[model samples]
Target: MTVKKGLKDAYSLKTPMDSVNLYRAWASTYDNDFAIKNDYRSPSEVVKYYSKYSKKTDTPILDVGAGTGLIGECLREQNSRKIDAIDISSEMLNLAKSKQVYSKFIEADLTKKLNIASSQYGAVLSSGTFTHGHVGPEVFDELVRILKPGGLFIVTIHTGVFHNQGFKQKLSQLGKCISPPVFHKVNAYGSKIDKKHGNDKVIITVFRKKMS
Candidate 1:
């Protein structure tokens, strides 16, 4: 994949919010420039892996930071289930909505309190939230609260130097308050061409909420 020098430069920035804004600005060209590259297989693989354990029930799925609904579309392809996509960027959600891949799209920051109600989702899946540091540990509680008992939370994180052990520990602490959620590493892949910095080792993690 040919990496644009401008995107490479942007990836080297010190803050995660810089990357988020950069993505927000490039949301229009995101699919052509980044998402479709690498055979569009990275995010597709994430959804495919998680779908295996998802219950056959027609439960609602929430895709956090659901940029352009790539993962959501993949999930829909795997199973005829309803998906709600949420992202902070309207531009991104606009592209996602145009595809008609999600049943609902909400513009909201996952790091803040999500407006979603407790026990609303049977499963929550996120493909690109943690890697860019757009979300921190505090958001896990909201994710847990939004999921029904025995629900699943699937997320992806960068595995190399950028991985936040401190934030993971904080999430672990918060897990103690919820029904014991178990975290398991699912798969690893490369980031977008713009995110070539830090060696960009993408690791997907799955957390399943225990039934009461």
Candidate 2:
């Protein structure tokens, strides 16, 4: 797919390849154009939940779909160290690396086996990653695999993905591996400057890996 030039066009992308192309094109101004412009709040909300439950600030935390490191930046504000980032777009990852917030970064698709070892992170945070045509419930097992036993993970999923894509069923299938999931409503559009920016529906799920 030819990369779209506008935020509206980016949202219309329907495939992972389309996502890759779009992010590559948007990397330079992603934060300003998308997160800030749309009043994106998933990163800060995910971090708020993660910090409340997580005791250590220096332990490794993986930021899936870390994008231009928006979540990493927010994580740092909470005094979090040892943050690692992974995104499918090298362009985005490179921009993230430039911020010096994440300890490391890897380019990989969420729907496949990651290059890192299992049980490597103390916690994981993701936002704006699971949505239309990006990734689906298939990534759950690998997410569980990478998190240490008892590791906490907070992620936001598009409301459509959560309801229409059998995310609840996938949670049921992994009952043996994770704690019961907790759902939090996320303002899909929380622009402080835009009074009418809260119509989109999304949910943030927080859960923990279980010890074998």
Candidate 3:
């Protein structure tokens, strides 16, 4: 799928391939155009919150949908633990590699082939992924599968009326099955800038995998 040349390419997700292509095309200016405007504080805030409950261990962190290495860079600054970032777009991963924030970068599709093993990561962090509207239950299941017992999964979601019903219920069910993971509402006032794209309310949800 080739990326469209304008703003429509940025907000619309016609297919999973389109999302990958769009990010690949937008990688050069992704931070300048979107990251700063929408989620400037997301990476830092995620690091801060995760640090409060857990210490940085030698175990690696898996950053899903890790575009441009923003989250990996934030994690690196917090401590020197290994960080592996994965994205579907080689262009995006290339941009992320240029930042020199992650220890490893892999190109893979979360919904199709994760390529990461179960109980391998100490934490799994993602930002700006769920909000993109492409992720579904399959991605969620893969995320849960990759986490070690007691590992952390942090993510942000575009809030809407739909969050109160269908999506919320699915997440609740996921939490129950995935080592009893618990969701915490993260306030957006400190981490995100209010923007008018859609009527979606963005919220961060942190889940802790239960210890085996």
lDDT of 1 by residue, 1-212 (tens): 43342334433545546656766677777777665653344467568657656776526888887888888778767777888888878878998998786899888877678788888888888775665335555677888888887787777765642345455675567665454444445333345444434244455566677666
lDDT of 3 by residue, 1-212 (tens): 63434334544675679878777678887777666655566566667766765655526788788888888778777777788888888998998898887889888877785777788888888766775445654577778778887787777665642264355766777766554444555543334444444334455666766675
Candidate 2 colliding pairs: none
In Å, residue 131's CA in model 3 sits off its true spot by 1.4
What's the TM for model 2? 0.91
Each candidate: what lDDT?
A: 0.67, 0.82, 0.69
Which residue segments of model 2 deviate by more than 4 Å?
A: 1-7, 192-197
Q: What are the root-mean-square deviations of the candidates from the true structure over C-alphas?
A: 4.0, 2.6, 3.7
Name the 10 consecutive residues with the lowest summed lDDT in model 1.
2-11
Best by lDDT: 2
The better candidate by TM-score, 2 or 3, is 2
Query: What's the residue-level lDDT of 140 in candidate 3?
Result: 76
Query: Judged by TM-score, which candidate is best?
Result: 2
Each prediction's number of clashing residue pairs: 0, 0, 1
* Order by lDDT, highest first: 2, 3, 1
